[model samples]
Target: MSSNPESSSRVDPSIVPLMRSLALELVIYGPIVTIYFFLVLHRTNNWLTNIFNASSTEYAIVAVLLIGGQGVMLEMFTSWLLRRIGLRH
Candidate 1:
């Protein structure tokens, strides 16, 4: 409804940094997470299979714990990485 077309097309300056940070995080996390899962799956395939075969309930609990622990560890690692790279304080 506004008369000015330029104003509608303009991006907020404050959002640029946030977008950059998000892009950087995605770039950093993508390969690390992929390699992490690759290694985990490769190394733990047999062990996890055994657990699943032994008891579904136990497997479910262990799977949840592993996922939660992975999330915590990855977050910590990513935060530390960002600090080291001077992207975050």
Candidate 2:
């Protein structure tokens, strides 16, 4: 309700770095994740299908492990990349 227009247009200074970090992460992660999935699917499709056909429970367990491993590896790789690029410490 104030007369000052500047206050309405202002962004929090503290949020700028966070926004930049998120943008950078998205930009970097998008293609890397896409390529990762492409390669993994390409290489593992037949093996995974065979496992699934042999045992549903084994397939479920392997799927969970693969997902968990992907998450961990992606995080590690992203962090390392960011550090190497001097964007993150």
Candidate 3:
């Protein structure tokens, strides 16, 4: 058999909803997380320490990594949920 729809790993490329979610998450959490890490935990920055906030050349690269990993987790979760509902091969 060719196979059922849910047997594949292919994700639709449109991804508009996921892109929107990614942007909103970056806007909401990126600065806050970076600031906390740099100023609070690392204690290497001051209020005016925009330098440690995040280099422009690397705009929240770590944050993007975390968010991207979270996206993969979410996809796995959805796949598991769908399988539980008999929607998968």
Candidate 4:
């Protein structure tokens, strides 16, 4: 169960900032999701809510989109951050 730091080429120092940014994204996502649900509920006015609730697939779709959004946001943010910091490869 011993590990060697030099054996791992997958991680780079530049990735540290990106990892930090992703952590920040997770912190932000919670509030964003909460607000998004409230807005959806407001716009749907119970009809769409009931429709989504009646079908697990619909709810699952929402969950997928939410997670996808997080992933894309992390990737794009990291790429943009790298470019901004002149760390792009």
TM-score of each predicted structure versus truth: 0.67, 0.67, 0.33, 0.38
Report clash pairs, candidate 1.
Answer: none
Q: What lDDT is obtained when candidate 4 is compared to the true structure?
A: 0.68
lDDT-better candidate, 1 vs 3:
1
lDDT of 2 by residue, 1-89 (tens): 55878787975567666677778878987998889778877889999999999999999999999999878987888888777666642
Better of 3 and 4 by lDDT: 4
The global C-alpha lDDT for each of the candidates, from Candidate 1 onward, is 0.82, 0.82, 0.58, 0.68
Q: What lDDT tens digits, residue by residue, belong to model 4 across residues 1-89?
A: 98987778765557777676666656665686678668864675666577577998987887688679877976786566556655435
Q: Write the per-residue lDDT of candidate 1 for residues 24-89, one digit (tens) a residue.
A: 888988998889778876789999999999999999999999999888998898888777666643
Q: Which of candidates 3 and 4 is the stronger one according to TM-score?
A: 4
Q: CA shift at 11, candidate 2, in angstroms?
A: 17
Task: Please give the TM-score that candidate 2 achieves against the real structure.
Answer: 0.67
TM-score of 3: 0.33
Candidate 4: Cα lDDT at 72: 95
**What does each candidate score in C-alpha RMSD?**
6.5, 6.9, 11.3, 6.1
Error of 1 at 29 (Å): 1.3
The lDDT of model 3 is: 0.58
